[model samples]
Target: MIRGVGSYLPEKVLTNAELAKLVDTSDEWIQQRVGIKERHIAAEGEFTSDLAVAAARKAMAAAGVTADDIDLIIVATTTPDYTFPSAATLVQMKLGMHHGMAFDLQAVCSGFVYAVATADSYLKNGLAKRALVIGAETFSRLLDWTDRGTCVLFGDGAGAVVMDMANDEELAAGRGLLSSALRSDGHHWEKLYVDGGPSTTGKTGFVRMQGAEVFRHAVGKITDVVYSALEQANYTVADLDWFVPHQANKRIIDGAGAKLGLPPEKVVTTVDLHANTSAASVPLALSVAVADGRIKPGDLVMIEAMGGGFTWGASLIRW
Candidate 1:
């Protein structure tokens, strides 16, 4: 069962107007193209793990579970404090958890859904009793500030959730994760990717994307995965109570929701507020909906995301 959710955005805000000063684009152009008004940027010394730990602490409190209760920790991100030690271990240490297994998963923006599915499998198989799944990113560090196309489209943030083994009664009640579908196509990786990596250049790289190509493929890919998940859960579009998609772009979100025939109000969007926080987007939107009392217990929620590497996935959850 998904026990609790939480999120954290850094204090600094970068407005589209401010971005115009750095690039040739204006606020009007950015808003028309990406629908982002502003985004949050992490402080100089604040790393991905710092944001992850802050979000994790809130999740633990909401779930009423202590650090000792978590037997597994999985953090999903492309940006790690170091390439050696997984970001999950860093979060584990900060949370004072020492007895559990911890690791990191990198699926770019589709990371949180991937992590959730992996964590669910471990819990179902009794590999762990409780798991902490976090989607955290310092994407601002990966942006080319001079390239307005990418820089204005990303931000930094973290979001997390606590999933515990549900009892038989809870399963009978349909009160946890229902089904998930994941897909990837490496051929289209160049459509969106980082320019450098440890193996390639031994340096953290900036974000690179073919915006038109990505936009062309996003709706179709997202709809396929979402429908696959819905089918696995024995559900249809009418059965969906909410659609929390990755906050990548307003155009993509609207396009996918429209293709699925979901009403505007049923879609949970934070792209305008946070831009694309990469892996952090979906969980951050989920946190907002939950905290606002829009997503209640017994509600059926659907989540989907597509990121660099052409990775895309969807998961069905019964809150």
Candidate 2:
């Protein structure tokens, strides 16, 4: 069974009022359109690995496991501390975990679902016993503060889950992940992307995006992916107990829910509170919903995300 989830947010809070000083946008404009009021920002000394370690410790504690129990670690993010070492390896070292396969997965906002699905496959195939799946991002490192379009649309945070293997027979009796679906289209990569990179400019660059274009594809693709996940699970839209989607934009979340025949009340939204944490958004939303008791074990949960790589996907889990 995938046992527990936990999250960590940085100490510094970036309010819309403060953002106004950096860009031409107003607090009212941000709230009315994107629903973001404030977001967490990593301190100068903090890095993505720090957030991942904190979240991973919490998840391990909640699951009643230790670092020794984890056989695999998957860190998902678009923001890494460096280009050489994988973020997951950094996290493994921080956790003092020495005996496991560790790597990173980059699927932009859908990274958590991708990591989770990969962990599920590991457990289901008996290749690993316990897996640590983390979605950590320090998006402040990627933004162009001068650009109002993308600057106000992101935050920094991390979320994690600990999954343990379960026998098929036991799973059939309700002890394992039920279903998951993931998809991506590289053709839409330019819709949103960084302006420079290591090979291109010999230095990291800021993010650039077509906000309206992304907004158009986001709602439709999110709804379609959610429906596909449900269909694959042999379930219908009505069967979902909670729709935990990427905390990108308020309009996208609401629009996708409505398009999926789901009521606003059935969706879990944290965009107003957290903005888009890239790969961290979905798990962060899931962590919040579970903490609020809006989601629980034995309930049907659907997670979906759309992001910069123009990558998008969804996962259905019978908790």
Highest lDDT model number = 1
Error of 2 at 121 (Å): 1.1
Task: List the candidate 2 regions with Cα displacement exceeding 4 Å.
Answer: 167-170
Clashing pairs in 2: 298-319
Which residue pairs clash within candidate 1? none
Worst-scoring 10-residue span by lDDT in model 2: 169-178
- Candidate 1 at 90: error in angstroms? 0.6
> In candidate 2, what are the lDDT values of residues 1-319, reduced to their tens digit?
6688899999999999999999999999999999999999999989999999998998898889999999899999899888869989999999887898999999888899888888989887888888999999999999989999999999999999998876676577663666776777878888888888889998778888888889989888898888888787788999888899999899888889888999888999999888899999988888888888888877888888887777788888877
What is the Cα-based lDDT of residue 255 in candidate 2?
88
RMSD of 1: 0.7
Candidate 1's C-alpha runs over 4 A off are: none
Per-residue lDDT of model 1, residues 114-211, tens digit only: 99999999999989999999999999999999987789899999999999877889888988999999999999989999989889998888899999
